[model samples]
Target: MQSGHNAMTGFVTVILALVIVIVGLVSRWPLWVWPFAAGVLSTGAAASLVRARRRRPLIPPERLLEPELPIPQVERWECVIKDVSLPSLSEDYDFQFSATVRWLPQEAPPNAPVVNAGGLAIDAVVDRARRITHQSPPHRSSLVQHRLNGELATMVADPSGRVLAMADNVRLTLADADRERLEKLATVRKNEEVWEHERKWEQSKRAYLGEDVLRTPGSAVVWWLAKNDEKIDKTVSDIGLLAELSSAANDQSVPDDFQRYVPGLAKEQEPLEAMADESTTGPPSPDEYARFLLRHSGLPDGDPRRALYLERVAEAAKGAGLPDVADALLRMLGDFPHPPQSAGPAEPPFDGYFDEDPPYDD
Candidate 1:
């Protein structure tokens, strides 16, 4: 647009100049049509300039990328397993999931062991997203978590099923099967958590003194999602893998009464289920949970009381919904060391709000 406007302006200026010259030359060529001569010169110059500008393409013409051909509608023929041939990527068996399938979930690696959708075995290879079904498990919902564990030879169409390519990422997914597993595991996990929380003080104090960690499920997926704690010092991280867990959970829709019907799960972590939906920022633990605490504390870098604030001040941040406060307090230990004189217990764990970030209301 700018170029065209400049061209038009230049053309008009040339014409004006020609008119002036013609008027000046009229005195010399009294009988000649000076205006005609001026018009011709201006028209020629403007035409040539406009033509030249159009010949140059704006941005380089991009090569035409081939679009994928639509998949043929299979007539649904039952080809009995005369010889069932599945897709395999490497003869030496090196699984490569370098890139993830765009349609498949990118939250976790598309591996069988990770998802186990619909209760399929760990060795299942997902060729494509087939169908999702909600069958009840033997006692509850029929949930099987399935994931792929190897590089997949993807079927790219060339009119016929002749050309197959190994995509950088496998299309591993957890359909209804996987979701069922996650929900069930979550219930069992909740049960374990409640058991542990009932005795976390005993567990942590003992571990702090000498005994080994009480060894709960660690619920890696739970923390991976809602870890507002410091990732630097935390054992788990946002970058870590929960594709296995997430894929399984996402594959199926949670039962309408998932929380209610899920016997032990929703019961165990009532605070978490009630406080917030699972996110990439769950609670923190002892190991590296402290580091995550530092990041969320919003204190100045290297605050002297940060450790004490986390360890001593934030202990007040606890109640029915706080399963991960330990890491928060420990991370902010340097900020608030000693609690207020009349803030309840003097040597309490951490002293401020439980459901919210610290400093306190009263």
Candidate 2:
């Protein structure tokens, strides 16, 4: 557009100068008037073009980047199957196991596992998390409370399925079939995650177009897509194998009520139900419960009172017959040492929101 304007102004300047010279020669006006007029007009046109050029954007407006959208939160269910013990009380049994689950109950934050405490931000987080359901990928939901040994232990799931709480010799007996079933479920879930990641990586390759793909005559482009495709295929193959194994172990369909983010994770609810039995002892104190909830939260970098509070909480858990919880607390006392005073009830565990820089060739 600037170039077009400059060309038109130059053409006009030439025509005006010619007219001025003709008119000056033909008219009774002084000859100096025409030269003066042409020079002034030329100077004015040059000045205008220079000003317009300075104002023009170097890159087209459409090509300039818009405000970057917040990184999309990929909902993911991070399940950790810590320990599998054998035998339900019955001769015939289904799979039962102890596991920790971290539900990203929402679209997930751009900087998840560490969201802002502001009111609007909190609302958005809650809204996202509430959309959680059984069929969603990247399952996000609430924490699971179960008994580790005799103690009531509340655990927020971590991505790496480590035993968040367990006594030295506390084993929940499960039948051989149950153990096999749980193992199969674990295999399926793990491979499913791998498959999803591989699929996303493959999709990211499509972002390149125009000269990016054509510049090198498809040398790097072919290899790049092929490599990702191979990864995708391998993951799919692994998932198929695991799924077949799972189907072989239990041909029966999972009941509708039994649906959970991670299959078999609903089994954790069994203990909670048992705890509710009138014969069972009482629940943990509010403070003990509160402390357990906080452990799952990503603590701030530093704070002074964390050590003292953790010591008190550990003592409370041990008193409540949850040595596993106490021990877990001891291990983590040094791990996320600082919890903000207003951190409140810990939010459900979520995938950490790092910027998505899919490793792909451009």
Candidate 3:
């Protein structure tokens, strides 16, 4: 059928060209004009014919195409109860148990080994939930908390696979103060982690964009180093881990030989003197103050103040729902000569959600 169509098209093109020549001759056109018009028409017709010849389909759409199958849609719950509470009698003799579960958009670490308590993986889920909630950043902490709560809210079974009372709408409420504290913690942890990560990343960049590269004037290496220096400086400023340097500057700690070699020592003296005169009101709570000291402490490990700082910081960390940090600070006291029992195991978990820190036990 295509061949027949092409033949018909060719015949029509020939008839049109003949008519054009006839009209040109009847009008007494120049001899050169007749040949030129015929040549342009013939060339255009040949090109069109060639293009038509080359336009064959490699595979016919109707022949090669297959019908698309409908995709199967699966209905998923907003939250799924991963584990139910083990059956146990309450003080009032009623069946009692809780569950550890996960919410939708589940991206938490896989649940750990289950401790069999009436066939319910209570311990495993609980531990996993703990790990998820342990994230330090405020926004991330809140998100993880929500996810944990979602998992917990969906619990509908007892340890023996028996259905328990389930709420139609599980809504966990938090007081404003409690919410604020969590947000503060999460933000602090996030910033601290980012500062640490960026610090390490800056160190790693030095291998490629070190001082030696910066010394190469007008080169690509020099440009690269300059660009990276801005980022490195910003990270350093944000982390603000310059307490040691600042302390040294303020204390006239530089040796004579170092002063002779290093410039700007004399110029910094006025500012240092001014800073020494300004007094701070100190942090609000012992915990907040302790954290400040922990971050800003510039004392040497063997200095007497080092142990004092750590001790105070540990107290503050514990009060701030930062048991891990507090424990770490306490471990730093191994070198100090205090009573054997002072360095005993950690205090028990804080009593209620909003409970005040109990008096520090020796």
Question: What Cα-based lDDT does every candidate model obtain?
Answer: 0.41, 0.48, 0.50
Residue range 303-351, candidate 3, lDDT tens digits: 6667776877676677877777677677656666553345768766544
- Which has the higher lDDT value, candidate number 2 or candidate number 3? 3
Model 2 lDDT per residue over 174-197, tens place: 456555766797799999999999
For candidate 1, the lDDT comes to: 0.41
Once fitted onto the true fold, the runs of candidate 1 whose alpha carbons sit more than 4 angstroms away are 1-17, 25-29, 32-164, 167-178, 200-362
Best by lDDT: 3
Q: Once superposed on the true structure, which residue ranges of model 3 sit more than 4 Å away at CA?
A: 1-32, 35-43, 50-55, 58-127, 134-362
RMSD of 2: 47.6
- Residue-level error in angstroms, candidate 3, position 164: 24
List TM-scores for all candidates, in order: 0.20, 0.17, 0.20
Give the per-residue lDDT digits (tens) of candidate 1, residues 148-187.
Answer: 2122334232222222222223322233554565679779
Cα error of candidate 2 at position 320, Å? 99
Q: List the residue pairs that clash in candidate 3.
A: 137-186, 138-186, 138-187, 287-316
What lDDT score goes with residue 353 in model 3?
Answer: 49
